[model samples]
Target chain A: MNQRLKLFWAGVRAEFPLLIGVFPFGLIYGALALSSGLSATAAQMMSSIVFAGSSQFVTAQLVHGAAPGLVIVLTIAVVNLRHMLYSASVAPYVRNLSMRWKALLSYFLTDEAYAATIIHYEEEELTPASHWFFLGAGLSLWFTWQVSTAFGIFLGTSIPESWPLDFALPLTFIAMVVPVLKDRPVIAAALSAGLVALLAFSLPYKLGLILAALTGIIVGMLLEGKESPKEAL
Target chain B: MNIWLVMLLGGLITFGMRLSFIYLLGRFEVPETMRRALRFVPPAVLSAIVFPEVLMPSGKFDFGLDNHRFLAGIVAVLAAWWTKNTLLTILAGMAALLILQLVL
Candidate 1:
């Protein structure tokens, strides 16, 4: 295989585990969107148009409750603020790519794709073919999301409530994050973020997630800053 | 306000945020502190999501023994820590949650 294809498949392989988790998530989103009074076409289109998991779910709920258009739009913006952090995190590695490539990859920048691609980049850094891996991961996730959402729309509320399939997402995240906690600062960041998420769980529009992430990052940075002075003792 | 219009606006905003840094960083330098903080983004953000999902399965905190998701999450954490494998961790977590739900 050529280098690009090889890298692409490598990305697909790395992202396979997360796809298993996201597939069920997309299905639930589709089912929920329909039940929330969205038309079949609108619910399916949201998967492609909005292309976000959590925010799409929130939008469906608000629509069900008859929220105004401006309010839904505002809520979506808040819910998706985390993507900016994701954009920044992956920016340096893809800076050399063309504007078209950047736009394409940015469109694919879901949590699963970011996790898979970042781990690959941290290990392998930038290569001529690294962007292909990002493309592969992103495309595969996009395909899975669209298909699963369609299935969900077809089989609304039929999926058993007892299955606990959504737990796979958190498990996937735990797998991704735990391996990265290589130092005290990183550990502190994860713990702080987790604690804050719980404490701020009631926040509207999922703002707690952004707040918790910022708190964790600050805690990590502060501890790392103190590390040099502490080592001199 | 049509639903399609709402979706279009929301989608544009989302795509803009996703593109913002990637597009700007190519034309300008990212600050040193921002570069360093980026390293923590994965752990911090992923934990922020994972913690809430497991701890508040029903959108409320439940740390008691009967909170099977919390217990299952602990098992998944241990599995991930030990194996460092994504698939195994998910399988272990699902299994733990199933067994707990069945038993309790």
Candidate 2:
């Protein structure tokens, strides 16, 4: 076998552990997206279109709640803002690739892909086959995400609508966000956003969510920036 | 406000973010403040959604024990905080919700 293919398969094998985690989320995302009032086509298309796991889930929840298009798009951007860092980190190694390769690789750069690629890059950073390794890691994840989403959608269609499955959406979000709320600013941010969301619930076109999210971000940022001596203690 | 349009725009923006630094490549450095702000986006955004759903289930404040989702959400929070397990936290929250809704 060729060295690039050998490296690519090694990258794919490395992704197996991470795949165990993402596969279920993809399934639940498909199930939730459907219950959130999206058509089957839209639900499946989203697996490819947005391609970011958390942001796709958030988009489904917002769409289910009848949020306007603009707000949903804005939320997607915010949730995915972290990807910029990944792009920067991976750029130098793949800098010699063509524009087409850059664009394709950028689209494939999910959390799992970046995780696998970065570790490989640290060791084999400038190897000619490094991009192939990235492609292997990314393509494996993309395949799994799509297949799992389709399976979830199939299962979603059979479940009765009266079962209150939609509750899973927020429940899933709680599970994800709660684990990350250890820091003081993050805790404050969560509290502030939750409160603001309630207060601004009646705002037109669901603009309140955007308002609440912004307020939380700004508050968290300000608190972090103005760390007092007492906080240091 | 079409769903397809929203997705198209969202996808493009996501692609842009993922491509931004890579394309710019040593030309512009991300500011320290911006980096710090990015860390808060997930908790802030997710909380904004989770809070309204649980606390305002009917689009009005409901703080009583009868509010199953609110109670269940708290359970999930504890499960997540303690275990840091995604599947376990979800199962705990769902179980709590099911039991609460039936009892209340």
Model 1's interface RMSD: 4.6
Candidate 1 clashing pairs? none
Give the distance in Å from residue A164's predicted Cα in candidate 1 to where it truly belongs: 3.8
- For model 1, state the Cα shift of residue A103 in Å: 2.1
User: What are the clash counts of all predictions, listed in order?
Assistant: 0, 0
Most DockQ-accurate candidate: 2
* Displacement of the residue A166 alpha carbon in candidate 1, Å: 5.0
Question: Candidates' DockQ values?
Answer: 0.54, 0.64
For every candidate structure, what is the RMSD over all alpha carbons to the true structure, in angstroms? Answer: 4.8, 3.0
lDDT of 1 by residue, B21-74 (tens): 999985777676765677677688778878978888888888999999999999
Candidate 1 is graded, for docking, as medium
